[model samples]
Target: LTFNIGERPTFRRFSTPLNQKNLTPFSRHRDDTLNDEIQSIRSLLDRASSGGDRDRASALDRAEKKLRAAQGTRKSYKMETRLVPDPRQKQMFENKLKRLSEQLSQCANDMKALRGNQQRGELFVGARGDQTNVRGEMSGDEAGNMMINEMNDIQDKTKSSIMNTKNMVSASKQVGEATMEELLRQREQIRNIDDEVMRVDDNLNRADKLIQKLWQADGHGQVHTVLRVRQHAAARGRHHLHRDDEE
Candidate 1:
């Protein structure tokens, strides 16, 4: 912004280099925007996947595409907002995070149940495999026909079980991915809020601290919930798996 006679004019706006501290609060708007986009995309995807309509499935695919785009945006925003020292926002961003996290946690549990069902189907196939093997050793004509029939039946059931597993895995992965996205956003939001609190009021001791603590605690609880569900599903699947082996 300095102009001297017989000298080139220089723009001070571009003269000074941008630093981390200066860019911190400016990047938060993008974070908020991306967080909203992710929530909407997830909701749409959820609704699209529901109902008995094949059309809904296609819509769900579209929603997934949007969610991916939003995630890309969020990634860039996170990189831009790294360890921002000061945040100008309040504690208002927590509610959206809490809702998204809880909803995704429920979705995770549902996926766990689906996984259990898939395992049960696998056990069914395993049992059939044993039965077919035993019948194949028989030399009698009746046993031969029975073994052939059992083999065909096993093939059909095995295909069904495999398909079920694929579908369940797909669903679980979709939900798991969405959950991770929301969790990351929530953590960033919390970090920014905490940083803001420390910068603005170093000596503050208030009920808001408890509130933030609860929010963090709830996030941990959601993770634990997902882990517990997976553990339970694995244990039940193992039980059924062992029972099939014994029989």
Candidate 2:
């Protein structure tokens, strides 16, 4: 997967190898499709009624299928790439998947709660009908109390779902913060390395200059000694070594 930092992150269209004929073609639009399915499910959940159990169940099924497809696509993408993705991209993908999973869980919980309410409503209706025929079996007050109890149970579940969602959001936020901190730490390390390289370069330049100065001083000292020997030989009126040998 190609990660362009400047653009909005998107799952690009990728081609799989011919050897992997068994896998479905991963679409670039899969993310969009998954999001649409989730939104549809949410809408259905919102409009859920005692009588629309079938519709809710159907939406749930569709959502589950979409989630599975998304998961499969993720697996396929991982399998196709030889190179590991950038950490930031990987984290983004993981966070998105986590969010989708949480959404699915919430949808499931809502569906279950709605289903329970529908069942309780049916029971309440049946009990009332039976009470009309059977005397002193179940009072109207008892039926009302049963419904109130069911409502309270549903409320409790709803509260739990909300709390769970909040916790997940908080966790996701923490993970993102950690990732940013890690990136910042790595950047600092890189800057330190660059600074160290510059310092080493400066030291090397200074050492080179010192070596050049030493070499120049040694050459001048040798030349001065030779001049001194020549002057001494001239003062003593001595010939050169080669002229002495010829004589």
Candidate 3:
């Protein structure tokens, strides 16, 4: 119906399958990268639990070591030893407690010593332009003053450390006392539990005897129907006798 003039400047056509084919390898490569990333994430998740456990274990170990050092004991006592009810073990614990007291006393002495010799030659320094201090012989005094300053610094640090140690010792003693109290409470609880078990067993045994007696009465149901009937009959006979006596 129209003359075939010229081709249009632009044309629309459906995308060829070859274009999609070109993207297949790239898509596969991207999927592999994503898969690798997912695997890394999964690996971290798998290891997270064990790593958390290891971290917890390390922290507990460090705390144990520090507490032991505070108590002046290099020996690592097992957690079970605290539960063993041995008289000799009790004596050992007492001895260790005594040692903590002794160590505290030693720290006190160190503190005293540091305080007594605090800044012996503080603020004493060199003088210049003098006969005895000619050619600056008193220059040596500057270094001496520095040495004194350093000593004072060291003494101050030692005092602080001693106080900290004393505080730690006190805290350790408190912890020990608390631990002993808890142990005593646990022992009491265990005894109470044993008593409760015995009582339950006794009650169970009584219940068993009751059940056996009931079974002797009836096989289907553990009820003493025959004995109950006998009792009821005896009561009725007693009532009839009372009526006859009244008549």
Highest TM-score against the true fold, candidate: 2
On lDDT, the leading prediction is 2
Total residue pair clashes for candidate 2: 0
Candidate 3, poorest ten consecutive residues by summed lDDT: 120-129
Badly placed stretches (over 4 Å) of model 1 are: 1-25, 83-247
Tens digits of per-residue lDDT, candidate 2, 198-227, equal 665665566556556655777766656655
Candidate 3 regions with alpha-carbon error over 4 angstroms: 1-138, 217-247
TM-score of each predicted structure versus truth: 0.31, 0.34, 0.31
**TM-score-better candidate, 1 vs 2:** 2
Summing lDDT over every window of 10 consecutive residues in candidate 1, give the lowest-scoring window.
Answer: 134-143
Compared with the true structure, what per-residue lDDT tens digits does model 1 show for residues 124-209? 44455555443222323434465577789889999999999999999999999999999998888667655655643432343345
Q: What is the lDDT of residue 91 in candidate 2?
A: 59
Clashing pairs in 2: none
- Model 2, position 228, has a per-residue lDDT of 60
| Cα displacement (Å) at residue 169, model 2 | 64
